[model samples]
Structures are given as C-alpha cells and as structure tokens.
Target: MDFRIKWLVSVLLIFGGILFCTAQERSKPLVKHVVLIGSDGFGAYAFKKAKAPNLRKMMENGAYTLEARSVLPSSSAVNWASMIMGSGPELHGYTEWGSKTPELPSKVIGDGNIYPTIFSLIHQQLPNTKKGASYSWGGIGYLFEKNMVDIDFNGKTDEETMQKAIEFILTEKPSLTFIHFDQPDGAGHNIGHDTPEYYKEVEKIDALVGKILSALEENNLMENTVILFSSDHGGVGKGHGGKTLLEVEIPWIIYGKNINSKGKLESSVVTYDTAVTIAHLLGLKIPDFWRGKPILEAIKYEEK
Candidate 1:
C-alpha cells in the first residue's frame, strides 16, 4: 500500500477506536431502577422484632439508619407527600386528612394535589429519563403525569401492584421505581400494629421483597441499582396518628450500589430526606427549598 494511504487508514482506525471506547463509557448501565419499598406502619421496634428473612438480608447487605422519623402527625398523607416532594409540609400542604372548610363530606386524601412529586422534578431535570412507577394505595400517581413517566401504573390490586413492580424491574427497567405496600399499616389500622394480622401482613410483604430481590438478581441489577426499603410512618396500637415512636420512627435500609458498606446517618433523617437521597442518586440538582441532604454515604459500588 502507498505510504499516504496507509497513514490515512491508520488515523481513521485510531479515531474510530477512540469513539467506540467513548460510546461504551458513556453508555448508561442496565442497573437503572431505584426501588423504594414502603412498609406502612412498620416501626423500628417492629423491624427489630420482625422475623423477616428478606428484610434481614437487606439490612445485612445495605446501609442502616435508625431514628428515621416521619413528619409531625406522622400521617401517611403528610409523610408520603414530604417523601415525594423533597420538601416539608409547607410546600406540599396536607397535614390533615380533611381540612374542615365549614361543611362538605370527608373526601379521599391525595398527595399529588397537595404536593409536587419527585416524578415531576425528574421530568423537568432529565427529560429523556423514563421512570418506572406504581403505588398501590398511596394515590401518588396524580403528581406524576403520564408524560413524566413512560410507564405509569397505579391503584392496582395488591398482588397486581407487587407483580407490576417486579415486571418493571424485569422489562421496563426504569431509572426510578416507587413501590408502596399498603399493608401492615392497613392491617394494623383494621386490627392492630402488634396483632397477628399485622404480623401476617409483614410476612406477606417480606415475601414480596424476596420476589423483587430475586428479579433483580435474575436480571443482573443488584450491582448498579439502589434498593431502598423504608416506611411512610409506623403504627402503634391500631394506627398512626401522632409523633410517638411507633408513629415517627421507621425502618430505613439502602441496599446494592455498595450501600451495604456505608456509614450511618448521625442526625435523624426525616421523611423528606428520602426524596433528597433519590434526587442525589440520579445526579439531580436539588432545589434550595429542599430541607434534606442526600444520603450519599449509602450507595453500593458498581463499576461504571
């Protein structure tokens, strides 16, 4: 071959090699889902006492934070809103189940109407990023409009919701998936937090966790994604209503993404911190109004 032709070909090959490497480096990993599993009315005491193998496995392989308190009143409506908005009750105003405006029958409580959710923030920040979403009973879908997430499924049966969460982990593989289990808390309300029914619900929830973990492992997502298991609020005798330990303190666990080996949060992390942690995970710039810090220490290490 002529010297000039050989030189040109060599240069093009080298340049092409560089581009290939760069593309590989920039390629987003398969580990995209951020599973936020909420165990309603599950308190620290319940976590410690509960004989849940799946939850125990998560604790052993994830970061632990104690004294994680929900907001004042500790009601689901207030706390879940705080979690999704990355703000306190002030921004997402719905502290009470129903604000008595003189007259009007009691209506269903909703978080989206009162608060702007993380889904909206995610859409605004990362327009191309699609999020996997499903909430059984939290009624958080209204905040995340259809345009915000490519896959939006809510208000499904408990079995259906749990299965959908697993399906998203397998097929959709969203960058963020918020899964809410309206059990234990629901059971506790109908029965009692410490009752047999509540415990049964816990067991069922643990099984669901196992299913999710199995899906992650089968789909090879355990190394990159962050699996967080938390509770909106804890219930006591029969329900959660006030700022008692049963109402405020709940389980906070972060698994995968090397989160298992991180240090704990010294200061008490509020419910709003969940949103902050999620935003931080996705490299989003949190707004100034956000009163919580990202739990950066709790990320599982995986090769990018």
Candidate 2:
C-alpha cells in the first residue's frame, strides 16, 4: 500500500472513532429522571453530628454545599415553597402558616396562576414527562401543581411517604419524583432542634435515603436519575420562623448521572436552585420567573 494512502486511512479511522464517541455521549441523555428529597428542619450542624453513613456516602459521590441558604422566615412552608417553585415568598407568596390560598382548590397553592411551580413548568413544556410527589406534611403539596404530578400522596408518616415514593419510582419511572420527610421538624418542635433526638431522626432519614437509592439501583434506573437531597429550613431551638444562622443554614447534596464526585460547590446555593438544576439536567427550560440558576460547575462538563 502507498504510504500516503495508509496515513490517510489511519487519520480517517481516528476521526471516525472520535465522531462515534461524541455521538454516543450526545445520545445518552444527561438526566432522564430526577428525585428531589426534602427533609424538614434538617440543619448542617445536625447532619455533621448524626451517624449517617448513607448520606456520607452520597456526599462522597456527589457535589455538596453546606451553605445552601433557606428563605426567611426559615419556616418549612415558606422555604419548601421557595425550593419547589424556584422563587422566594415574594413571588410564590406563601409566607405564613396554614393554607396560603384557601379559596383556591387543591393541587393549586400559589398566590395566583402567574407563578407556576417546577412541576407545572415541566408538564406544560413536556406533557409526556411523568411527575409525582409524596409529602409527610400535606401543606407542602400546595407548592406544586396537582395535575402535573401523576401520583400525589400525602402520607401520615415519613416512612410511609418514602415507601410510597420508592414504589412509584420503581413501578412508574416518573420523570420527576419528590419525597418530603417531616420527622426532624416534628422532633425539632417537640424535643429540640439540635438535640440528640433530632440527630436520631436525621439518622433515620439517612437510612430511608439509602433505601430509596437502593430501590432505584434495583430497578436499574440510577444511571439516568439525578438524586438531589436538601432540607427546607433549619431550626434554632424548639422552632424556626427566625433569621438565625442555624435556622437558615442547610446542607445540599447532589449525586448521580454525571454529577461531580466529592465536589464542593463554593457559592450561595439557595433552596430554589433545586428546581433550576433539575430543569437544566432534564433539558427543560428554566422559566424567566425563576430566581435560581443552574449549578453549572457541579455537573459533568468540561468548562470552556
């Protein structure tokens, strides 16, 4: 064979291999499913003190930030609302306790129809995507659009809520699934926020997290699912509704599907960022009304 022809063939083969690899990477969707787990009244200090092997392992395999800020008054309703809607109380307008808009029907909890939640946005943009949520505190249901979630369950306890969510994920393979646990918040109000009892509840939640992950793994869906774990707000003593550091500081953990392992995000990651990041991963558009930005660096992509 001619030397020039041989060299040309070698170069063509290398270029073809590169093209194939690039095509494969693009063919694999960055995120096909998202699991957002919200633990009420879970603070960074309590997370540090608790013996949560599962959580630690998740953190080791994902990008985390202990400084994820929660919107004030630091109450679960307000912050959870903010987290899901990707907006603050000023926009979503669910600041106080109880039902925000009692006049509005169930599955619709925002101030008006203007500020739709992440679920609503996802469903509206991609109607084919399946979404669901299970909450221990029923009030949290108000943050999301009802029709958007295929399976919505407000359970009696955290265990029941998590079990139902895991079952839903395994069986239905929802594009988005949210699970809210309210035990730490209950322990915070009943006993103390930073007490040993609160830590025990945190440990239990960690175990629950492990179970949820295991279910995803068992179903072979972990590769395409992005798992994000965070808390609504932290409590100071027996309650929140304050502006203290302990009450506002929260731990945010992101794992699975190209997320950086053992990565630490050095930025002001608020609770609302959850919606933004999820939207970005699933190739959905982040609405202009959203106040959060995607944590672009934490994801697996070579910075240009």
Candidate 3:
C-alpha cells in the first residue's frame, strides 16, 4: 500500500510538470518568422471574381477580412507607409500617392530620422535578426529605414521583385520579409479595376504568393512562419485616390504558426493594424505613439 501511494504521487507530479511545461510553451511567442506580402492595388471586391486558389486556401486556413479598410486617400505610398508604420498619414505624414519623403514632419522619428516602422521596431528589439524587403515600386524604398534592413531590393517588374524576395528568404532566412508586387496596381491604373485584366494581374500575384509559400515549405520554414497578406489600396475605373469603398476596401489575411482559423474576421481591421499584429506575433513591445492595436482575435494564445 505504501509503495503504491508513492508511485501514484510520483506519477501525478510528473504529469503535472508536463502539463505546466506545455502551458508555458504555448504562452510564449510561437512565431519565429513573419512574412508580409502586399499587392499594390488589389481590391477586396475583386476576390469575388478573381480565381486565386492559393489565396483562397490561405483564407480558409487562416483569419481574414475582405472588409479591411485603407487609410484616407487610399493611395499606394500613403497606405503602405501606414501599414508598416502603425500610423496613418496624419502621423507618418506621407500624404501623397508618390511621396518620396514625409510631406509633413513625422510625429515621431526613430533611428533613420524617419517615422518609426516595423523595421525600426524589429531592429531596436531584435538587433541580430535579419530583415528584407523586395518591391517593384521604387517609391516604396523611400518609406522605411533602409539602413536597418539587410536587403532592400527594388526590381523593375513584379515578377523580378518577388523572385528576389524569395531568393532572399531562402538564402538569408530573414526573421521578417516584406514583398510588394506592383502589377495589380499597374493593371488597375492602365486596364481598370474590377475588370478581367485587373483580376488576371491579381491572379498572377497569387501565383507569386504560392511560390513564396512553396519556398518556405521547401526550406522547412513554413511551420514557424506567419504570413500576412494585404494591399495598399483598391481602385476605381482606372484611377484610385478616392473615398469610395471600391477604392478603400482591401483584403487582410493572416495565416500559419499560432494563428487561429477563425475564418472571415468580423473585427474591423485598418491598414495601420498590420504593423501592430506583426509586432505582437514577434513579441516586441509596441511603440507608445502607434495608434493601432493587435488583432488578438486572430491569435491562438491567450494574453496574460
């Protein structure tokens, strides 16, 4: 009887220890890497007609919202800056579609004498971690802190840009990677948004997304990598920079590594929230000046 009681107590203690360790592991940050893919002007409305199986699969497996909104004016530079900076044009001061620099002085400046961005946050918090950005648009190069990034490649075409980004991801295995494809916005401007041509361009961008996913999977990085897909803005009839829903509504999708498959997020998501979400996933402290909050509904871990 004494031996059996001792054995039962030992088993209970061991089982309790295992449960505690499992809980601790889950409580800690689960994401080791983050990849943000932005399409220049892919509209939320286009998803209804666009046949993008890869993106659709991500939507089914992750938390997404087609009703996510862009900041005012809904232009490329303004919204992209907002997305990565965790603030809107009013704070970051990139008021124009082609702003090469802050038109107005930024509210808060970080290491590069520019507005604080996710790159700035990562560089400050995770000093040794690698960061990379690849984009077809040259204007995007002016928005973030280039000095902090390991690779900032600006390609002349969307395909070249995505390829370079993939190469960087595979070679460097960066902790954070941001890729921007310019074809959809270009097609939206030239061919017109909601048109078959624009949808085709968006489909091509989806294929590029598939390539990135495949690269991550082939390199055994997908399981621990978190991917967030979004757009700078939508468009209306060959031109954007408007207040219409058709021009302001963008799709936001978050998948992989501790993300819950809530499927179709009901909470309102804005462009600036993207940065906060990335910071949250990487377990970095949020800047005091950042107005956006993390979309906690998409994450599986409970906040302590």
Candidate 4:
C-alpha cells in the first residue's frame, strides 16, 4: 500500500474505535441506585423564600424545576399514590385516606390492564434488587406492599426519618430507597404556606436533606445514584386539597448519576411521572398501563 494511504487508513481505524467505545459508554445504564426524597407540602414559593443552603447547592448541581405540577385534588394521599403507582386516583383506587390498615385489592402485581405501584413492579421484575423506604407519614405506608419493601420504616419526625434513611443507605445499600419528611407539611397546616414558621420548617428539611446527602457522599454512593427530590403536594392557606397554584405546583430536583447540572429544567413534569422516571433510571420495564412518561431530557450523555 502507498505510505499516505496507509496513514489515512490507520487514522480512520483509530477514530472508528473511539466512536465504538463512546457508543458503548452511552448505552450502559448510568444509574445503579435511586434515592427519592419526598418533602410533604414543600411548595416552590416556600422553597424560594426559605433559607435552604443545602437544597440550593443541590439545585446548582442538578436539573431542577419549580414548576412541576401535582395531580388533581392535591391531597397527600392522592398525590403520593399517583407518584408511586404512576397512575391517577381513578386507576390506583386510592382516592382518599381510607383506613388505618388499607386492604390489598384482588391482585398484587397487576397486569397491563391494572395499575401497579413502582415498589410492587420492582419486586416482581427485579426480585434480587433490594428496595426500602423511611417515611414520616405512616399513611403513605398503605400504598406499599409489605413483602416488596426490604425496609419499611415509619418515623414520626423528619429527624428520625433522615436518620433511618441514612442508616439504610449505608448499611443495606438498597437498589432503591425513599426518604420522606413531614415537618414542612405539618408546618404548612399549623401556620400557612410561605409563612415564616413554614419557611423555618423548610429550612429544617433542607438540613435533614444535607444529612442524607452527606451520608451518600461519605459512602461514595453519590456518583452511581440518581437522587430525586420532590413533594407529594403543596398547600395553600393552612390546607391543601384544592386546585390553586400553591396546591398544584411543586418543586422537583433531579441530581447525581447522569443528570445534568445545568440551570432549571423547563420540562413539564407531574406527580405521576415519578414512578416511570424511576423505572427508566433503573433500567426497568415501564408498564404499558402507566400514563406517566420519563423525563428523558434530564439524562445527560455524549453521543459519538
């Protein structure tokens, strides 16, 4: 072969190899673990007014949107159910806070016809992968399956919830973990949304969030984890359950793993999108019955 022709072929082969490697890297799933943080009644307005240094820092490193909308009715039970089940109240059949012990329906793992919670779907699809949650609102416990969750702790206060969540992350290292804080909601009901006392609670929740993030950092799990910070519903005038702006709009922050650290995300997201997004991040099969769609724009990757 001619000398010049041989050099051009060698350069082409090298570039092709590089492109192949880049494609392989992009195809691999970026998230190994998912951490979902739920702060009840934490509205965007309150988040703006609150002195949440920790959460602000996280927003700087993640894709965030204060315009994320909640489901109709805007109640805690309805919204949590929508987020977990990836379906509206009509499909999930959890319209209201029913009983202290909510009974299981006909089927646990619903087919394409029936709606299933993300926990149940994960348990059925990825049996070996561990799943857990530490929630302050025990009522949310009704939405989960006992056998599906490895650790289903109901802490009475935000402090206890964060403590248990941090411990679970470090000790169990579950594939999926959910942490819920209830103080802000309680504060919203006690005082009012955007009130000084409510903002104080929001700040306190920020500190608790910092503790959990610190735990992840200490364990070196931040890079491989997708952390989703959100709220079930926002409140208005000392209560929620209305379609007003304060009740419908909430803040959502997606950080870590392959998430973009750019400015606020303009994507329109709702409570129902949480489960499908989690499934997508963990590389699980999204059920056809699910109405929510994954926020694919949040994923940042290079293509060759």
Q: Which stretches of candidate 4 lie over 4 Å from their true place?
A: 1-28, 97-115, 302-304
Residues 1-304 of candidate 2 have per-residue lDDT tens digits of: 6999999999999999997556323122368899999998898778668998888888888889888889877887778877878878777777765545523232334333535777876786667878889999988876667766799899999999999998898888888999999878889999998798899999999999999989888889998898999998888879887888798899999999889885688867988888888877877766666788788778896455
Each model's lDDT comes to 0.70, 0.82, 0.90, 0.80
Better of 1 and 2 by TM-score: 2
1 or 2, which is superior by lDDT? 2
What are the root-mean-square deviations of the candidates from the true structure over C-alphas? 12.0, 9.9, 9.5, 8.9
lDDT per residue, candidate 4, 190-231, as tens digits? 888878888889999999988888988988999799889899
TM-score of every candidate: 0.79, 0.85, 0.89, 0.85
Better of 3 and 4 by lDDT: 3
Model 1 misplaced stretches (Cα beyond 4 Å): 1-31, 98-115, 260-265, 300-304
Model 4: lDDT equals 0.80
> Clashes per prediction?
8, 0, 0, 0
